[model samples]
Target: MPRRGNRLLVVGLVGAAALTSAMAVAALATGAEPVAAGVVCPNPVDELPAIPAGARIQVERELSALDQQVAEANERLVSTAGQGGPNFAQNAILGPLRDKRAATLERIAIAIGREADRPEGLEQFATCALLGEGEQPAPTTTTTARETTSTTAAPEQEQDDVAARIACPDPTGALPAVPQAARAEVERELANLDRQVEEANERLVSTRGQGGPNFVDNAILGPLESKRAAALDRIEIAIGRVSDQRPGGLESFAECSLG
Candidate 1:
């Protein structure tokens, strides 16, 4: 009788192990496994104030974009796991994400301001974190890209504000009057030019401490000039479609300076 009882227990244990393995296999096959743990960002739009009816559509679009940004950032965090040093997550993924969010939030405020009072303190929503189990919530203090970079910046770099910032010529400043047909497209390209500058400045802030002396020019400003040049070409094409006189001297605006 004792031998039979031990045999039964052993069979039961084997059955349980097989069942667990089968379940795991089934989960994998069905793509039901949870994503690997990664950075989680907060949604600021959830806490947004009442949006005016005139601004509702643009506001909602920006809000949707905010969600998409977080999803992409989290995806990057998972894919680039163990790729960089301790500050890798911050400098590469989270910093750029925050800069993008800040820009988006500013757009949201501008959209709202066109119809109603502009929202204040949206900067609080910019920063994100990789929260571990039982970790404290992300800091709520409103830290701009400049302020965040300044804290860890070398003293000499901090002394010269120009070294820490970018100055790009405003492409729209010398533009000819855009025809009604080309106005919308021209405005969009102009906006892209502005976005290119904003991104370059943000990159400057995010990568302040790292890289060699020429890193800013090689990494940030050079690519910005290329992007601006492309945008300027698009603007000229947009104008050419609607007007006989395409804008000249746009190429001159492509190059940006560190200031």
Candidate 2:
């Protein structure tokens, strides 16, 4: 009876050891690590200025591209581990990544510039760092309710002082039937008019709280009206070139209002 008990205990010990080995293998196969290690890149988009609606699509695409660049760099870092010298990661991986990030950031800035003020010094966000073993990315700060209210109060007040966006009449809808010869030019001008409104609205949103009560009128709307008027004039000319009956009073639709 004692010998049988000892045999059972031996079998139990072996089973426990086998389970432990299986778990370790499973962890490796699943890429499950208690702590992550490799390169950690700062997300530049997190610091980006508010994107205007006109530029939102391009800006988002560039942001996604930046993420892809970081992922590829990290994969390279892991795959080439222990194969290169100490500076290999820096020269072969990190430096090129920084350049790619800088170029992508420039594209984002340009896209934003088409609608609102372009941000400066975006190249500063291009650098990345290698994280040692067991290290984690820095955590973002969390503000308490009281702190959040205090910090946001001024901005809210400023927003109240400014208009949210601008509204403009769509002159294209008011246009008469177009000739084939003038359709392309007229359509181009119509598109330009739409772009003008979009840019003005974006400017209004981005420049809230700046200037005086008449800021929207003196700055955004006035300039936008002038641009719209010019585009409308071109549309009228385009139609007149192909047809005797040209669209009249197009310039009247150029003036925009703030909401």
Candidate 3:
């Protein structure tokens, strides 16, 4: 009888140990924090905040409406380009459309907790470049012989002027540490700006001497220069806002490339 009682007690001890080991394994598998020796395993799902009622439906509706507006804007941009009026496509159509679309995208980012601002999603939905329409052609301008002579400059001098005008700011120490909440949207916008800079560079190279002597200056360089400047400015503002929120914020974002 004494031996049987001892055997039962040993078996009970083994069973308790096995149960504890199983609980620890389960916690680690589910990404839960390490449990203290005497603490019970926490429910990981309990850590997450509850989704607000109707939030998903509201976000979907807003996204759908924004997409419609973007489609209409693309149509208008193409139509204005086809009309062949100087500055009409850019100033009246594309500019306003880009502004509205960007604003809508920002709102969506804030609403859906920044996941919607990812590059893949923005490239698919927010970018106007994917609309399958060509850029407006530069309007023909008649130049007198004197005008041509006065306008033409040495290749080296032209390069120097371009280099001087588009001098990119050193964003190394200047970038603010983006909070986790705003990280997705800010990075998405920066990626978009980087793409624009790349496209501008490509356009500058491709359309160098295509339209006319002034084509490079009027159609390509001027607009691209403006865009690059604006992008850089906005990037600064975004970073600045984040830095203002916390100490050591600027230094924390060492990986960010503002160029």
Listed per model in order, the count of residue pairs whose N, CA or C atoms clash below 3 Å is: 1, 0, 1
Candidate order, TM-score descending: 1, 2, 3
Q: Which regions of candidate 1 deviate over 4 angstroms?
A: 1-154, 161-163
Cα RMSD of predicted structure 3: 30.1
RMSD of each: 25.3, 22.4, 30.1
Candidate 1, after superposition: displacement of residue 97 in Å?
29
- Candidate 1 — worst ten consecutive residues by lDDT sum? 5-14
Q: Lowest-scoring 10 consecutive residues by lDDT in candidate 3?
A: 5-14
TM-score of 2: 0.41
Tens digits of per-residue lDDT for model 1 on 132-191?
Answer: 333433233222222355467877767774455787777777788889999998889988
TM-score, one value per model? 0.41, 0.41, 0.29
Clashes of 3: 1
What is candidate 3's TM-score against the reference?
0.29
Q: Comparing candidate 1 with candidate 3, which one achieves the higher TM-score?
A: 1
lDDT of 3 at 191: 77
Question: What are the per-residue Cα lDDT tens digits for candidate 3 across 94-118?
Answer: 5665566566555544554643322
The residue pairs found clashing in candidate 1 are 162-259
